[model samples]
Target chain A: MTASRENSSSFRNHTLTVLAIVLLFLFLWWADGSMAEDLGLSFLPEGLNGYEVQILNLVAVYGILAISLNIIYGFTGMFSLGHAGFMAIGAYVSALCVLTPDQKEMMWIIDEILPSLAALHTPFWFSVILGGLVATVFALLIGIPVLRLGGDYLGIATLGFSEIIRVLIVNATPITNGSLGIKGIPCHTDLFTSFIWLLVVVFCTVRLLSSNFGNVLKAVRDDEIAAQVMGINVFHTKLFSFCLGAFLAGVGGALLGNLLTTIDPKMFTFLLTYNILMIVVAGGLGSISGSIIGSVIITVLLEWLRVVEEPLNLGFVEIPGIPGMRMVVFSVCLLVIILYRREGIMGMREITWDGIAAFLSRFGRKKENRA
Target chain B: MSLELFLQHFFNALTLGSLYGLIAIGYTMVYGILRLINFAHGDILMLGAYFVFYGTTLFCLPWPVAVVVAILGSAGLGVLMDKIAYRPLRDAPRISALISAIAVSFFLESLAVVVFTGLPRPVHQPEWLVSIITIGGARLMPLTLLVPGVTAILVAALLYVVYHTKPGLAMQAISKDIETTRMLGVSVDKIIALAFAIGSALAAASGIMWALRYPQINPYMGVFPGFKAFIAAVFGGIGSIQGAVIGGLMLGFIEIMAVAFFPELSGYRDAFAFILLVVVLLVKPTGLFGEKQKEKI
Candidate 1:
């Protein structure tokens, strides 16, 4: 009886913890609303402006993307460079779905099936879900044949897939409007929506990581041969993670498309995938919190570099005209980061409550011990 | 399409194929020796073209001198990259080295962007090489003739080096077993560095010729060709230099003919490569020229 009581108490604690997380997320969402008023703060020395907010939104979206990629790349040990392709699929599909019939007419082949989709013109939220589903379907198609190949071969295959997707989008003028790009997307993404979506992704991902399935996935990453011997179904695990990763990427892309209010084939290039890969590597692969921290750091650093390129003359020593200097600096930093922190900043460790407690105790050992 | 047009594109395809073959050789050689993809190889090619561009336009050097300078400069950069990024991680897992290679590639590309800006610069073709020659009722540029000749020479030289030289024997030994080669007192570092130098030199030569044909240079110019060349290397069997050359030429021919036959699918040119890669992977993971290796548990 006593043991049963104890089990119930621990279960209650778990419930409370979940509640607390939900409350914190709600509070953050509310805070975002108030922060919207200070959009101009981005422009001022210490203020954040609308543009900055938008950039932050982009970072949040990319954070979700990087985390999802980490699931496949870090956990499953699958080297996929085609995350951008999945994202593009989601973005274009979602954009196609959410846009009004008139808007569709302007962009895609609307005359044939306009009557059917016109009635079911779903909301932005539904379109986002639909987009994720579309991306998942595409992932399944690509993953089935390609996932069988291991290591560098898989990487090359995925990279090729990304290029194919890009070129297909460029050529499919009837549907994608070709390289001219799809424009006039309704601006539905903002801090509140992005923050909400970020929370859901984080929560779902955390839940997934804590589940038994996560252990099997990690096992595959650690040693594929051993994992296979243990009857873990390595291929299925990889495919699942790959599909989920692609799905999250799709959702992120949907949000990004909505935020930018425009979609271009060039925007979803291999460089974008490389940027995300850099973030994942810098943050520490296989660490979810690391992806979030890394995304914020990289996005902020990229934005701040604009200041370096400003036409500020430092009296006698004038800065020369360096057009793409930021990318140069960014790449140098990436190289340094890879050299020094090959395991990344967090080294596959997450920021848990125990870590927080240990950090707090360093400053006040006596008081923390008493507590 | 007219017979004349077909003949013209065929020559164009051959020129492009040979250039790809040159670059693909570098990829195949590095992969053969180190089993590393050396993703930065494409950027090295970009650097080579830029070197030539600067040599001719800024320093007023003749085209041949510029080409020589570009090749040497590229070879030096290749050695430096191997020493800095790859050598330390040689003992680590293959994936770690690959990631580092990718990072290095990105760093080089970004650095190029900073140095040369994102704007496209026109590559100046030498006056003598700019003229078109008529053959079999088809117009052919001097570059068309030069590319195949250079490719043939380079392939022969590479074959001879791999088969006849002491260093080639050492490379073959290392590729078979690194520890055994080291036990034999072969300087692994020097041999590896030499491989990189040769690979980079080939890439540089390819880049110069590519620029001559395309007449444009950009920081990101190498990305597509780099990928395609890598595909060519894979298609021909990654560790086989002869295979790489064949793979590259075949890829080039397929791409051009695909575009020529189906203009509607022209935009799907990149897609064609991916599909080919996927099909090859599904049917034969070891690639066309790749030897089957037993997997050890």
Candidate 2:
């Protein structure tokens, strides 16, 4: 009877957590729509209003990227610096799929080729999924050889891979459109759609983390040799985690591409990877909640700094004439954080209901003891 | 590519490879002693290049004097980095050290940008070094010849220092067993600092040469070479100096030749390094010259 009661109570807590998440998602969605309407923001150039909504959509896209990157770097304890490459692969592929049919009609050479592919037009959503699949395939291919190598070696390999991808994108003229970049891509990303996608990704990610597989992933991260000895196929586990991470990164890239309505090789550089890596490190490794917090903090801080550098200059205290002062300040903050709070804000722990309950219980216990 | 172009490209590869080898020596030396990969080493190379640029342009020093000053400056910076960023994390987990190293790398790059601005400065090579020398059918710059010769001499000197001197023995002992070396009355900290100092000096030397060859100096220039040199260090065997040199040269040769032969695949130059790294790791995780480590349960 006691065991059944405990099970029911746990089930109730799980349902409550789900309900809370759902309510939060709905609130965010409503807020996003209302903000778009209130500000008269549009996601595209054709619309006069909705600039705020477009920015919000961009934030959601980057938030997805940060969360996806967290899966590989934070959750799996893998130091991958090639995430931008995976993102580029997805962006380029989707751009190609979206542009090829229309491009055939305009370009002489493309029109002479198999007209059937040109006839079968793909929607933005289909292109996004295809982009993600292509990126996932690339991840698997790249991960197969490098994932077995642990620590710094993997980091180096991934960095090399990303650079390689950038070069390939630049060279593949017919596919990636070369240095000119793939322009006139369909703009399908908006605040509502982006928020919905973010919710799905966050939900799936949180669910995956709470599952049995998540436990195994954490175990492998804690000690790979020990985990391997205990019968977990360490290679497969890493590959799965890395590929899933890559897939989400691909989706993020696709959304970003759609939002911008263009794809450029230069857009996916090591700098992008570094920025995401910095966010993950600042968020706290191996913590989902930390990633969300870090992404919001970094994105909002970066955007807000534009105002700080411009019209909001303090009177009688003129700031320096340097253009990239914000980046310098950001780097200093990163160094200070690493130097002092090396474990980050929350360390490796998560923000869970149990944690909150424990804190409340401790406060009550302290009061009782004082009495 | 034509025969002449192919030969020139090969020589170009060799010159580039030698510089990489020079930098890889520093990376291997530091890793050998501490088992920690210093991500900031490449930025130190950038610092060296900038120092040389300033010494030559601002201070009106001769090329040789500028080189010497740059090398010394980089060595001092390396020691400072160790003291500030890495020394405290020695007792922490390896991952923490890695993160700290990364943070230090970002800090250095940002600091460079703040000081120098993001503009790419032109590195003016001395006219004597810039003059082309034709050997038989091939054309070569004086700098190219100087690079290989200097690299070979430096490697030889490093080998002699590691094998012939008492300090070398102490370094080797610490690498083999840091605790045992300390128990035997060796100052492990001083020896390790010495290794970093020497490594930083070499990296600075390579950086100066690289800037002269490329003729462009940017704050973030070290990112690619730093990563490639790390790959080279791994290819040769992380802890081995000779291995690093060989690995670096091989990588340089492969990258240049690959681009020269297949102009269509020129963009894949970095990919070749990545693929080479992946292949090397898959085939031999211990590396070409590395010994397999057996851990006690």
The per-residue C-alpha lDDT of model 2 at residue B76 equals 94
Candidates' RMSD to native: 3.5, 3.9
Q: Quote model 1's TM-score.
A: 0.93
Instruction: Supply DockQ values for each candidate.
Output: 0.73, 0.61
lDDT at residue A36 of model 2 (Cα atoms):
53
Stretches of model 2 off by over 4 angstroms after superposition: A1-55, A103-120, A307-312, A357-371, B1-7
- What would the per-residue lDDT of candidate 1 be over residues A142-235, giving only the tens digit for each residue? 9999999988889989988887888888876767777878889898887778877887998899889889998999999999999999999998
Candidates in order have lDDT scores of 0.86, 0.83
Poorest lDDT segment (10 consecutive residues) of candidate 1 chain B: B265-274
lDDT of 2 by residue, B1-297 (tens): 577777788789999899888889888998888878888999999999999999989999988898899999999999998888888877877767777787788878878987888899998878888888887668889888889999999999999999999889999998898899999999888888889999999999999999999999999999789888988988898889999999999999999988787887776677787788888888887777876776656
Clashing pairs in 2: A40-A49, A40-A50, A41-A49, A41-A50, A41-A51, A42-A49, A42-A50
